[model samples]
Target: MKILYLSLRFPYPPFSGDKIRTYNILKHLSYKHSISFVSFMLSPDEKNQINKLQEFCKEVEIVEFSKLKAYSNCIIRSYSGEPFQISYWYSPEMQKKVDNLMEKDGFDLVHVQFFRMAQYIKKYTDRRKILDSGDSFWLNLSRRSKLDRGIVWPLLKLEASKVRIYETEIAKWFDQVTMVSPLDMQCLLSNDSNLPISVVPMGVDLDYFQPGSKSDDLNLLFTGTIRYFPNKDAILYFYNEIFPLIKESVPNVKFYVVGNSPPKNIQNLASNGDIVVTGRVEDVRPYFDNSAVFVCPLRSGSGMQAKILEAMAMGVPVVTTSMGVTAFDAFIDKDIMVADDPKLFANKVIQLLKDRELRQNIALNARHLVEEKYGWSSIVDRFDKIYENALANRS
Candidate 1:
């Protein structure tokens, strides 16, 4: 099969949410399908990985996007009645390339990675179009608005409102659309009952994140790209509302905030010995191994938590909210322990720290869960079926 894969960002290094999903899917699907990638890149550093991607992709086109230009576009089109994301990524050059590709290549499918890129491909009816919206952007923005500041809050709400209308409107045009979690699929269905939506979840590299020897340090861990709204909110909520309660019970308890590009506020958290923020580490497996419990107290997010899956895959006991585990079909207290309340979340962590047997059981079950249901090969096979179904329904 031949696929024209459209990405908002060039998927390399696969560190962040959008990049991870796109890169993994390309790697897996490219083995069997001829994938031609068209995307944008911000930094020259990102181009280093083009060679790696070109190994699988038949052709790779990287559009140069600048921070200044993106912001300029954002302000210029804020009144265009479309979401800011859509405006920022709109490029006539890239659109011409896509239009030419469809005319010349005669690809089997047009696979777009996000709604931001949807504006470019939504009108392309010449091929079987599959929109892979990894998560519910509107739902996510709505949650972010709840915790946003005065002026920014209203802007976020406006964006969310626009996305709700935009996503539902565009859903009718695509042959099929995909989300990473069932909750997100529900969000899309709520918009349009008849829209075809499928759940193709984020997968973990099982062999890379295998079980390690548990450490004696009473360290609690949470890992994600620290600058992201979902992750930033989660760590702040944990530090301010939850960690103090745990500290009262277990005085020596330490929390490790692991991942990349933490802001000053997040970095300031490291001033106190209780919270240790590693801005950007090459690997996070050590944090998982040393942790007595992994906590994901995300206040607002619409899809699966990759950090939760990665820790669980590394055989780390996880304690997270109802929102945290919503994506996975994992059983509560069976595969992992769950609590929404700050006090309750702390108690779960303390309990796990004290009860080594229960901790190990959760870790073991979590590892088993991902191994069976969340590997890349298994997920790509599912995508294969969805592609076939989309083509079959194509008019």
Candidate 2:
């Protein structure tokens, strides 16, 4: 099959959730399908990494995006019905590039990475198209609107409303739609139950994140793009409400916040060194290698948390909230430890920290579960089938 793949960002480095999904899909699908990749790049440095993706894509095109201009576009269209995200990513040059490619390449199907990029192909009805909405933006914004306080909450509510309507209508333009989990699928259904949506679970690079020698130091780790609201909230919530409780029982326990681009507030938490904020590391496996437990205390977010899967794949015991495990199938107390309340969350972490035998059992169970279900090799086959089915129906 010849596929025209569109992404909001170039899938190189593969650090973030969307990039990881896109990069792996390209790698696995490229063997069976010829893919021509077109994506937006936020920095000039990204162009240098095209060679990495050339390994998977037959042809690659990267469109340079201006952050300043995108923000101006959003500000100009703020009063319009378009969602902030949709407006921010709108580029006339990108539209022109996609149009030229569609005209030149007789592709089998056009696979769009996110709804934000769906703008370029929504009008093309001559071919099969798949919109991977990733996580329902409406669900993510709605959760943020409620959990957030101050002036930004109103804007969040407004964006959520716009995204709910726009996302519902856009899915109708595609032949089929896909998301990371059932919870995200449900979010779209809540708006319009008739939209065609499928769940494709996220996966981890098992070889890259395999378990290593654990350090003797008691460490609790949370990893993600810290500047993201959900992650920012999770870290703050842990430090303010939960970390103190854990410290009472285990005074020497340390927390590590690993990821790129942490905001000022998050940076402040590392002042005394109880929390080590490694802004951006070349690799994350080292953090997972040294940690005894992985904590994902997300209060507001959509879709499955990839960080949790990576930690689980690395044979690290996980303590997370119900929100953290949504759409993830794992037995509590056996595969992982779950708690929502601050005290209970703290206790769960403390238990995992002190009891080496229990931690080992949970870690082993979690790793086995990941190997059985969440490996990318198994997950990408589902995409292959989706493409085949879509093309079959086209006939």
Candidate 3:
């Protein structure tokens, strides 16, 4: 198949969930398909990595987007009936590029990565599109608003309303759409009943994240891009609400917060002796290897949590919120544990920490689940069928 793929961000580095999913899926799909990818770069450094993506794309085109301009556009459009994310990524140069691409040798499929980038391609009525709005923006925004208070809260409430309408409105443009999980698919349906959507889960590099010997001390680990709002909130929730409860039960429990770009609040977590925030490690497997349990205290976020999947793939026992495990079909007690409240979540983590047998059982079960279902090769195979189905329906 020949695909014209568009993304909000460059798929290099594969650091964030969106990047990881796009990178891995396209990498695998490229083996059998031809792709013409056009995306935005946040920095000049990403320009150097175009060669990496060229391995998967028959042709790769990228434009540098200004962070200052993106934020400005986001705020400016926040008052209107449009998703702030959609406005943030709006660019004339990219629009012109897309116009030229569509006019040239036509693609078999046009796949747009996120709602943020949907504005660029959604208006093109002449071609069929597959939108990967993996993170249901409105649902995510709704959750985020409740977590916040006062001035920002009202703004978030307004944005959520705008996004809900925008998301529902844009659904009709795509020949088909896909999200990261069943839960997100459900969200999309609730907003727009007729929206064509499917779930193609985020996959893990199982071999790279394989299980290794854990450290001697009973420790808790959390891994994610600390720069993100949801992840920062999750870490803070774990530190402020959940950690005290766990410490009361196990006095010497160490919390290892590992990921890229630790914000001030996350960095503050390391001020205490028990918390260790390692900002931007080259490899995260070592932190997984040294932890007894992985906790994802996500107060608000939509779609799949990539960190949870990576931890599960590494054979680490996971205790997460109801939101955290929404992406998986894993059992509550068998494959992983779910707890929404701080006390309840703390108890689940403590149980895994205290009971070696329980931890091992959950870890092995979780690992088996990842190996059986969450491999990139298998995910791309599923997407191939979806692509065929889209083409058939279009004809």
How far is 214's C-alpha from truth in model 1 (Å)?
A: 2.0
lDDT of 3 by residue, 1-395 (tens): 89999988897898889899889878988999999999998889999999999877899999889888879887777667576767788888889998899889678888888877778887777777888888788889899888877678887997788888887778778888888888778877987677888888888988778989877679889888888778889988889999999999999999998888998877886778899999988888888888999999898989998898899989899999899998897888999999998999999998998999999999999999999999888988888888898888879
By lDDT, the better pick of 1 and 2 is: 2
Off by over 4 Å in 3: 71-80
RMSD (Cα, Å) for all candidates, in order, is 1.3, 1.0, 1.6
Q: How does candidate 1 score on lDDT?
A: 0.88
How many Å off is the CA of 381 in candidate 2? 0.7
Worst 10 residues of 1 by lDDT: 118-127
lDDT of 1 by residue, 25-143 (tens): 89899889999999987789878879979988999988788777778888998888988888878887878888888788988888988888877887776668888888998999998
Ranking by lDDT: 2, 1, 3
Range of the 10 consecutive residues with the lowest summed lDDT in candidate 3: 77-86
- Per TM-score, the best of the predicted structures is 2
lDDT of each: 0.88, 0.92, 0.87
Better of 1 and 2 by TM-score: 2
- On the 0 to 100 scale, the lDDT of residue 373 in model 1 is 93
What is the per-residue lDDT of model 2 for residues 1-395, given as tens digits with 9 covering 90 to 100?
89999999988889889999999989988989999999999888899999999988999998999999899999998888899999999999999999999999899899999999999998898789999889988999888888898799888988888999999999999888999999899889888898988999999989888989989889999999999999999999999999999999999999999999999999998997799999989999999989999999999989888999999999999999999988688999999999999999999999999999999999999999999999999999988888888888889
- Once model 2 is optimally superposed onto the true structure by TM-score, how far is the C-alpha of residue 223 displaced, in angstroms? 0.7
